[model samples]
Target: MTASSVPSSSASPARIPRRKPRAARIGLFGVGYHVYWGQFPGLLDELLAKLAVLERRVAATGATVVNFGMVD
Candidate 1:
């Protein structure tokens, strides 16, 4: 059918309804090799310290943070 043939009301685009925002949940995980801690001094402490900084930053965003500490 030609464009002119269609009704003007039907030709207009449909509007979408706005949705409410949802709360955010953030998950954090880290991994490390067990052997490296023995070989390199302070490696474990360093990693944990970094992760702690990250956790604070993520939490600052007002989202719930679930931090799963490092695993060997």
Candidate 2:
């Protein structure tokens, strides 16, 4: 059959609804010895600071970040 002779449907195309993706939950933790903190003086502070930077980066991704802090 010729293109001009073909029949066309009057109905419009259906559109699928879109949904937002769920946020992710992330947990962060660090480990350090108390003895090392005393020996190194600023070791604990430096480690905590680094952990904070990591937490900020993760949270920026629309995720819930929980920092458990230094573990022993």
Candidate 3:
């Protein structure tokens, strides 16, 4: 017990307070193949506009999006 008396507030180390992360239930799906949309005539509106821009970028990150569009 001799390393400069060992008494610097127990060498300072104790801080745990972090818990705020639980909002993600994303389930987007896109499978276009509806008989080739009459030989590629706008291909089913471009695959439903790219699945609505990937469901608006995954519902802007505060997720809970369930887009099951173009499921052919």
Candidate 4:
């Protein structure tokens, strides 16, 4: 089939990129984080940092992140 046959530019099979995986909501609070017994302060910081990086990667693909589940 010729290109003209396609009705719209977005008609291409691969025109749009696939969505990214939803950010894992660690806690039910919706802050995108959580805590565990015996967990140290440093560990939480690491986790938050990782979450931030994950958010950036997903955003780069032109997709919406699911949510930021956290607890107070």
Give the number of the best model, judged by TM-score.
2
For each candidate, what TM-score against the reference?
0.68, 0.70, 0.39, 0.41
Q: How far is candidate 4 from the true structure (C-alpha RMSD, Å)?
A: 9.5
TM-score of 4: 0.41
The total number of steric clashes, by the backbone 3 Å criterion, in model 4 comes to: 8
lDDT scores in order: 0.90, 0.91, 0.84, 0.56
Cand. 1 TM to true fold: 0.68
Q: Model 2 residue 22 lDDT?
A: 75
Better of 1 and 4 by TM-score: 1
By lDDT, the better pick of 1 and 3 is 1
lDDT of 4: 0.56
Better of 1 and 2 by lDDT: 2
The most accurate candidate by lDDT is 2
Q: How do the residues 4-43 of candidate 1 rate in per-residue lDDT, one tens digit apiece?
A: 8878984668867669655689988778999999999999
User: What's the ranking of the predictions by lDDT, best on top?
Assistant: 2, 1, 3, 4
Give lDDT tens digits, candidate 2, residues 1-72: 998777668757886766976779999999988889888988999999999999999999999999999998
Clashing pairs in 1: none
Q: For candidate 2, which ten residues in a row score worst on lDDT?
A: 9-18
Better of 1 and 4 by lDDT: 1
What is the clash count for each candidate, in the order shown?
Answer: 0, 0, 0, 8
Stretches off by above 4 angstroms in model 2 are 1-20
